[model samples]
Target: MKWSEFKIHTTNEAIEPVSNILHEAGASGVVIEDRNDLDKDWSTMYGTIYELDPENYPEEGVYIKAYLPVNSFLGETVEEIKQAINNLETFDIDIGHNKVTISEINEEEWATAWKKYYKPVKISDKITITPTWEDYQPVSSDEIIIELDPGMAFGTGTHPTTVLSLQALERYIQTGDSVMDVGSGSGVLSIGAILLGAADVQAFDLDEVAVKSTTINVKLNKVQDRVTTRQNDLLKDIDVQADVIVSNILAEIIVKTTQEAYQLIKPGGYFITSGIINAKKELVKQDLEKQGFNIVETNQMEDWISIIAQKPE
Candidate 1:
């Protein structure tokens, strides 16, 4: 079998959305090469060693690489991905150079090549996301480890948008509370909710692949009894109410569903949202407020923003 490695050269700000575009277009996990990682001071105490080549990294923007099987429709798929990324501009996202390149690689090589890019990352105080292939041990007794395999789905549970959402979840989720995870890609957030002591979680996504991925992840985490995965559009005609409502989707989609989020969340419930570009922060903030949600907390990482708001009692 043969695979095409699609590379997109763009700014760090565009990583989440562009990666999402590829995922929506049927690309599995992606390898993100960012020059910023080179400057980070990692503890040498960890047993595993990482050898990074400086030449492979770009001096400015990052490069995102995804693998797709070589097929007759490969060109059409790449074109659709390009158009989807271009659509991000209407939301005021900075796409940087927007250069795209492609190369061919053997399926056997691609199968194990992407593993090097994923490692155990502590995204929040209590949560550490470790890919299924990596062996990670918690440094503390209270640490929570999420075993994940992004597979052909988006959201590895390491993106800043995901980190922000989980951080907010850790802070707001109460034991025995009900959680509603909108756009539940990879089921990472839903799994986090259950691990955080939420008694029940209802996960919804418009994409069938995402829905399937979430179901598998929920079972992988051994929380199948606590989670229910379904396919549904964003907060559309859903009568289920939950104590906490969270959605880590595009800023525009977040704004579009603010009213429904507010309506579905019980009085005094919390609504946590991420996948927002810094430039569109105020726009989402304003919409959430207009929908009668009281802003509670705001978190920013690099160029992304997560806003948490509470419905008044």
Candidate 2:
């Protein structure tokens, strides 16, 4: 159960592309964090700052963390990693030459140990995610339920991107609307979408944790019949059309997936996007406009923005 931790220092701009490449290359979990976060030690705490809720900050940048199985680098793994790291022309990057760390662990022991860092998270006024190990009482017997221990999946509903995405979901979900949550981490948005009123919700994430978390969360919320989590990217493999399409991911991925989001929507359907840095507002706006989505409104919390757009009739 040993893991190889690959820390790559890349220009803030190249973080997403690098993550995508590694993800395609079969990395387990990839995380991006600000350089300033490195100073914070979470050995006793969560070792990571800024929850993945996506509803907290406005804009930020940092280093990327990608973890791979130890066997992936049995021999010369460091060298292979270095070569992969150096090949990226998307941004500036640095390495300590021998800074790569490879360590073994008892998977169960490590997983259990990390669960201590998890706590219950409140995503919105009506939605609450409590880890199985914590004590929490729902505002209502059935208002919302997301029983999960945070691991490497997204959506404790703590990050600005996720928070904003869920907030946007609150405004538009109707009792019978078919909804799609692209990059649905931990199935938070999908779960929220279902709780909010959407009858049939379909979600997708590129990560296995996301897929697994979404399934686990659906059961936790008792919405298995309404919310369906799929393993797909954008709408590349999801064939169903939806009334609402939500994406809480980086701007570059947003741009790349814009068309698919548009296609997923029925005429005049809605598209809600968060996980956008304030600086990239225009880039997203332009992409939406080009694809015939009229920007209805944009909400910003801290430096992050969540925009709501409508597919034209």
Candidate 3:
């Protein structure tokens, strides 16, 4: 079988949304090659080894690559993806170079090759996300492991936005609390909440592919009973109250749901928002505050920011 390698040259700030566009367009797997990664100071605490090659990276902006099966509708899908990414600018997101290219490849080449880009990495104090194919064991008795098959989802759960969300969950999630995960890509945040001691989680995503991916990941993590996957726009017409509401999506989308999120969260509960670029941090912060939330913590990993806000008791 033949496959098309669709690649986009875009800024780091645009990575989350562009990758999301590709996934929604039916891409099999997404690979991000950022030039900045070569200069990252990886920690050896988790014994995770890095073997990066400079040749694979672009000199300026990041490269977002995805695999799509060569079919009759391939051209239309690519055009839709391009338009979707261009539409991101209305939300104030910089699309950077915005150059897109495509190449043909054999199925045998990419089926397993993308797996090499993922491995076990301790993203937070207690949680370590590893691909399903790797043989990884806990180095500490209290360490938590999350196994993800990125081929079936949008991300491997190692992105900075996700890491910040997991870290916030580790800090705020009570043992028996309920969590609502908006924009639950890969269901990573929902599964992470369950593993971190939340009794139950409600995972919602606007995309059907994301909904399916979340369901599969929930089962893979053996948290099926504790997590429920639903297809819904962010907090639209949702009435359930949760101890914590976490969303790792665009800041513009996050602001639109501030009122709904505030009403849905129980008093003293928290709203954790991520996938916010540095420039838009103030926008989310102001929106949350206007909705009566008290900013409890703000954290940054690289260029992304995660804001943790709480409802007053």
Using lDDT as the measure, the top candidate is 3
TM-score of 2: 0.72
- What CA root-mean-square deviation does each model show from the true structure? 2.4, 6.2, 1.3
Which parts of model 2 are misplaced by more than 4 Å? Answer: 1-109, 140-143, 206-209, 237-239
lDDT (CA) for every model shown? 0.87, 0.68, 0.91
Ranking by lDDT: 3, 1, 2
Model 2 gets an lDDT of 0.68
Q: Where is model 3 poorest over a 10-residue stretch in terms of lDDT?
A: 41-50
Instruction: For residues 1-313, write the lDDT of model 2, one tens digit per residue.
Output: 6765566655444544455555545555555544433433445432243344333212344445555666744456556655676665343232223133444545554445335435665556666667666777766765566665444455345555777787788777777899988887777788788878898888888777668878887887789998878788677866678999998887767898888788879998999998787888899999999988999989986567898999998
Residues 29-118 of candidate 3 have per-residue lDDT tens digits of 899888887877786443454599999999987999999999999999988998999999997889999999999999888797688899
For each candidate in turn, the TM-score is 0.92, 0.72, 0.97
**How many residue pairs clash in all the candidates, one count each?**
0, 19, 0
TM-score of 1: 0.92
Error of 3 at 294 (Å): 0.6
Once fitted onto the true fold, the runs of candidate 3 whose alpha carbons sit more than 4 angstroms away are: 44-49
Please identify which of the two predictions, 1 or 3, would achieve the higher TM-score against the true structure.
Answer: 3
